[model samples]
Target: MDLPRYPYHQSLEQRSGQPQRRPVVIVGAGPVGLTLALDLAKRDVPVVVIDDSDRIGEGSRAVCWAKRTLEVFDHLGVGEAVAREGVRWQRGRVFHGEREAYAFDLLPEAHHKMPAMVNLQQDQVEARLVRAVQLEPRIELRGRHELIGLEQDADGVTLNVRTPDGLFDMRADWVVGCDGARSPTRTLLGLGFAGQVFEDRFLIADVRLAPGVRPRGLDPATPERWFWFDPPFHRGQSVLLHAQADGLWRIDFQLGRDANVDAERDPERIRARVAAMLGSDGFELVWSSIYQFCCRRAERLRVGSVLLAGDAAHQVSPFGARGANSGVQDADNLGWKLAAVVKGEGDDVLLDSYEFERIEAADDNIGHSTRATDFISPKSALSLRLRKAALDLAAHTDFAKPLVNSGRLSLPTAHVDSPLSTADAEVWTSGPGPGCPAPDAPLDEGGWLSEQFGRGFVLLAFGWPVQAPGLRVITLPAEGVAATRYGARPGSVHLIRPDAVVAARWHRFDAADVAAALARAHGRPQ
Candidate 1:
């Protein structure tokens, strides 16, 4: 359901004489902004999201969502909706010289409930998030509102916004910028976004399927599959196909270096490319455009009272499906911390960890995307030959198949050095370590690790246990499911945070030590 727009005067009056500003103001209504708003709102934190666009655009930009991002969406209560509309691909086939060269199936069915990746257009994703945001009364989504400037002090941030009518100011305890790569908020903070830009350009077109011509390698009736054609446009071109729920397909092709922008605008050229790629499969072009890829990182993610998330902070080439996934992860990392500080559960120091953790994740993503891009589109003769040789060898070697398909190419985050992780503890066979998510395993009472613990502290007690005040501890039998899953041995304990990351572990299960660790993890002194 679309939200009714508020009159400019009414909005201004509501801001006047407000005793308490929201804990955070998120600028930009993209998936990152909306996801952060919903996450914080669920935690009972007041949040407002502002976007310059009055409505979601029709452009089909981001097309793939990673498995980790699907988990985050599930936590936000929109995963099922996404899954219903998304196209799931469990297998990928690589072709060389117009013949199938390599094929790899993703993780076996036992490893995941869904496929490793899904094909869902960014516009549809925005729609789902918008619906979820509207259902949350605490989350205010203001359209046609732009953040012009902001000033922050020790306590809060006062922002100047320009709406369709005029200018006004709103205050928040913290400000988050999710406003994309050319972020005005990032500019105001004097942050530098530095990186390398690939000079190659690509044209993207979203089109409807014609009567007989259907996308190759995917069933026309199934909308959950994607097709990638290498040497896409010609010898040096690439084409990506994403099937949409509405019987539409998105096609992306690399433009020849000699091609001009006018070449992209020519519908005949696009149709010819699509026809050639589809090979007798017909399609009608709906929309088309061209873009250049870049691999860049923000020098700093935080500047005083303002913080950056999503594309606003960093950008990666659209390879390995990193940009949208990384941005959503950034929102997940920052949302809870913002809520904790606002509710007086933690100090500002807790906010600093956002930069520490997300910056590292961004760096990992950039490296992964850069390598993937280089592998797919090698720039030099030597690199091209190397990639082809590696692919050729993989085609002949059974042992090398997994390496090519692991998509482990998208690096997972480990919080080994995060200040939030508790160190200097005896190694435990049963509990979670710092910077690690609690492993999913069965409980004694026919439950799961996520089912046993709510979005708060979970203390796992194995073997003989001692009582601790203000903590939720679940005792398990010796060598039981919990012990096996969390690597917990007898007489050990684990402290897990709401985000499911293990805060600390102890082998002895000493009440005093456990108390101190929990206090520190929760940002309180014992």
Candidate 2:
């Protein structure tokens, strides 16, 4: 497949004298920024996305997109292309010295719209998103525009952006940072990025297998991931193998802090490592990089009119594919709230939920990544002994299998205590609760319930509309997956927020109660 290049395009009408003002100015047009732009545009809020790149990034970075991210992409209108072009996998295996230690399945459920994970090249994913952004009427994507400076105050933010033409000042009601680890937006805010930096550096590379080449023991037909804990080929280090789209494979090798970064990245050296593991050096190396990443987050995600999302908001080690996946979810969570605030339908304080909920999510992912990293690359001899004992025991003992953590993988974070939730008025069984992403189900007519979301705040009613425009109602019969998933009675109701999170639910429907819940979701005082 040919690579994708996004030519620089200037869609925003330039301000010659006074800088033009927009509702939202997004910096960095990666997956998260593009998703936010499309999302806000769908909500009828205009957005301007600024990025320095003229093309999708090279290589397959962040290839493991999780299922929940795919669901959010469906609402953004690019999920079909992603699901069609990506390689789907759920099962994975962990090996300890050539012996299979354990095998696991990520998504055991059968009815999900997408699989547990999809391995698509980062460039391909960005290309699809770029196409969507270009076609969106309400979004202006300015490529090769560098955000050199930002200043925020009471009403809005002023950004000094440098384009190929020249530097110009622009203003927006809000400025969002989707910039990666080193964020200019974060720097402008003087935020203290705090977290632990792991001592080990990782070598990540993508390689295309020859027409008939198969790694010594890997099955070209199977999509399962294989992780090694102290493998024979790599000696003390751990390695990860993933099958990607287009007959490509991603290999991650752990290099201790002392490893010479330059020497380790040489093509011949990397090729020799692959030959050691695969018993052949026929694969063509596509890209290789040596870098150290930390699991950290900004001191705060929201600071007045300027906010952070994606890598700019927080970061985690690449072990669990938590970085990009969580970043996409961050954009999804903030888009509706920001749109509401901009359109006067919600209080500006509604943006608080973005900070509270996503920070909670960031902490959760950091905790998982930290534990996975420790397990993968033990810091001390004691830790190494324990990890090895566990992996070795996992080969024969079921109890030990549960202890092996080759990255817990990524799972949707439930915002159980979000301030936006109204708490269940009464007890209910089954289905999701307040602050949980709505449980998707097959409609009695043979579609998905989540497919009906992202259209703004709506009520999940088992029967009919209960007379509230603010809570637009959708009826589902009391006898099917919808009923079982929602735990709803014939007349019960569920208030789902615009972002598809449950704001509240009740065993009985009442217009007055649902209205109050809707207001609460918008950050209106009770």
Candidate 3:
């Protein structure tokens, strides 16, 4: 059997031309996959993404975008557009009852470049990412195409894809399985997806709120705010309200364990619940559905040439807004490593680091999200009493505020053993650390940390004048704007990776130390 030609143009011209396969073949066109595609494309690595979905749709699922996700978009150059469409949320009010409510402001100082969180529908986010993916010349997006099977060798992977016409085999240096939780690719590898499934089911409805009773502090025209109500439908259920970009409000109601799933599906039952909560608000129904929440993690993220990401790798409860955010982080983490290995800048063993770093991050996210869900869901009688009691205490004490907000919403990475952080340098102590994103700091030139560091490796030197010669370094003044912007001490230097992660930091160290750190990260001593 003659293999297809190696050039994309020739392969397309011959119709059976097997252009030299891309460095990576990504399955699934969701935000995770698209994000990986865009990042790899930006690094000039050829990539092909296959998705069964032909078009993007406006759905009310996974609507919260955290600051870390926003930072990622900023790196991709679509942050402004996302911000334009998204509603900035600085504070959240949690209600124990109608009168005993407590409000916490998420980003009070407003000094950071990105807001703490943004409320935007998941569909809108996908649309933006898809557009970005399409614009990249190195990315070939095959919609309506499905991955039927794939086999991996010591050097590369051969994928079997099914299209409307027939099945075709393509080879690639690497394969990424961003396919959702029930991932066929994962099944093909016989990898186990281990986690728990919550028995409670929740109904999500997207509807237009009547003009008279629009929720306070929410823009009727823009979907920007979230509201959580307790004792929904009865004394035990909970409800969540989210504003959508299309003037529709997304309402999630918890149906007790004994409630009939069929009855909840009825349009009348859904509308009745909406009316009961909003009270004669004349809400017009737009969309309604019910879904069970699951908390699971793949036994392994990488199986030879295949890699799992997004919901395929781990499914977390939605309470802490970790689902999409963590998925995107997985995409970001894997994208650069794939680009490096495929381009021959690094060894294939670098691929193993993706699982090493992201799997732990995913597990951490699951643990945090699970705790948040348990606190909010209150499955047992003791759990319910503890939740109510905690809420009561939070209403009055400042000590409880941090406890409630601790894991509810934050993107903190564990980089202790990551290859990215091989140095014993105390960089993580000053601010951002390796395996973790660099903190957003103001720049002297009226920009943020991202603007100054802009794509690729950056070395911030505080005092010494030694240079890597070939590496990019931005010098900071000893006591001026750069110092204020980066919170740089008099003799410290911060080394940032291509993806804007702090690879290492030195506080008044020898030039040899900086060279050693860079050598470890780039595989060559400066």
Candidate 4:
């Protein structure tokens, strides 16, 4: 499929030779930046999104969009389209050599609005996000408008941008760097990534099978993630296979540190690898590349009025699908808080919470990614022997299955330690707690519980008539999935943040208590 190219036009600031200050200026018109722009626009906050490139990137860089990311995308107005167009799968099979070790399911439970994971090419994902941004009136997307330099003061940030017409200056109350790992915005802010780089490399090939051709021993119609450790075709190495939309299959072959990078990138060599595994050559190589991944994050997520997000803030190995998934979550975490601060409903304290929560999340992802990398590519012979033993025992022993880490897979991390969460004053046996993403349940009325939350605080009152001034209060019967998931009983109340995180919950409703918890959620001292 041909990638859509967004037209680049000279900005008004460049045409009029006067700087315009925007509420939020997002650098990089990729998925993260565009998602943030749409999110902020939904909050009635105007945003200017600029990118150095006018076209979607070439390769299928990120293929796995997790459930939490899909939920975030749903609010941005592209969730339905993404889910429909992407391949949905939950089952994954892990293989040790030629034998199957075990299988796992990502979403064992049902009734959620979105699936466990969706595999859509990165380019297609960006195309959908770009179209969404275009439809939103409050978001101004300017392609080929690059940020040359930026200076931040107490009040706002001044950015020097280079456009097709000429150089221009623009100001923003806040600047977000969604540009990739080598982010220019991050460079300008003098931030550095502090983490470890894995000593192994991987070769990725996106292939489209010819007519009537299918992978050996696998149903092409069924989508499943396949990970192999020391496979027969690729001995002493790990391989990952993911089925994507539009007949595209993403395959990653582990290449040790001393492998020839250029030679491995050859189309014929990649084709040979695919043929060796599938026992068929009736496939066209769509894209191929070699990369060495790292589990690293920026020194700081925020510096004054400028903030870093997406790959600019953190990076992880592709093993767990953490990179793009976590980046989109960053947008979800920041959108409402930044909008509140920009609209004068919140202060610096509220915005700073984004830094704390996302940094914590980043560290968690980095740690997991690091562990996956180490297990996949053990540096020493002793570690390799241990990994082999673990895999050998995993097939028959339940105890050793946990030791086999073929990328733990991506799952949303709850900010249970966040300072924004109010301590639970009551005990609950079930349901999400403070600083946890609100679990979706099939409402007795019809739609899912998440469909009712908006871009503001939501108060879920169970079996009681409760009203909180200026808050969306949802009254529900204390039964069914909603009650079961929330552990809701008579007079139980839960305060949900704009991002659908549980800020606080109580056994009974009290307007004053709800108000105080809401204040704490907004970074105001109760």
In terms of lDDT, model 4 sits at 0.89
For model 4, state the Cα shift of residue 119 in Å: 0.4
Full ranking by lDDT = 4, 2, 1, 3
Residue-wise C-alpha lDDT for candidate 3, range 37-97, written one tens digit per residue? 8888888888888876677644668877888788888778787777777766766666655
- Model 1 quality (TM-score): 0.88
Question: 1-526, model 4: which lDDT tens digit per residue?
Answer: 5666777997788778888888899999888998898989999999999999898988889999999899889887788899999999999999999798889999999899999999999999999988888888998888899899999887799999988887889999899999999899999999888899887889998999888877757687778999999999999999999999999888899999999988887778888999998788988888888999889999899999999999999999988899999999899899999988888887678768999999999999998998989999998999999999999999999999989898988887899988889988777888899999898887776988777764789999999778789898888888777888888898999999888899999998888998888888888866
Q: Candidate 3 has what TM-score?
A: 0.91
- lDDT-better candidate, 2 vs 4: 4
Model 1, residue 166: distance off in Å is: 0.9
Question: Model 1: per-residue lDDT, tens digit, 1-526?
Answer: 2333322333642456453466688998898998899889988998888888767766778877876677678778887678778877656666554655567555443424334777778888888888888889998888878889888888789888887677778888889999999999999888888998887778888888777666664676644334343544356555656676567787777675566887577889888888777775477787887888789988998888789999999998876678988899898788778788888987677778889989989998888777766666668899777766766666688765443421232434777787777785564543446887666556667655654442567788878666878788778765865677667677777887766678888776777887777767655645
Structural similarity to truth (TM-score) of each candidate = 0.88, 0.96, 0.91, 0.98
lDDT of 2 by residue, 189-289 (tens): 99999999987988987888787788756786768889987888999888999988888899999888899988997899998888887777778888888
lDDT-wise, the better of 1 and 2 is 2
What's each prediction's clash count?
12, 0, 6, 0
Which model is ahead, 2 or 3, in terms of TM-score?
2
- Cα lDDT for residue 394, candidate 2: 92
**What is the alpha-carbon lDDT of model 1 when measured against the actual structure?**
0.74
For each candidate, what is the lDDT? 0.74, 0.87, 0.73, 0.89
Superposed Cα deviation of residue 453, candidate 4 (Å): 2.5
What are the clashing pairs of model 3? 4-18, 5-18, 6-19, 6-20, 11-17, 223-243
Instruction: List candidate 1 segments past 4 Å from native.
Output: 1-10, 13-20, 109-115, 210-214, 220-233, 398-411, 424-433, 441-454, 461-468, 474-485, 489-493, 506-508, 523-526
Q: Lowest lDDT 10-mer window, candidate 2?
A: 8-17
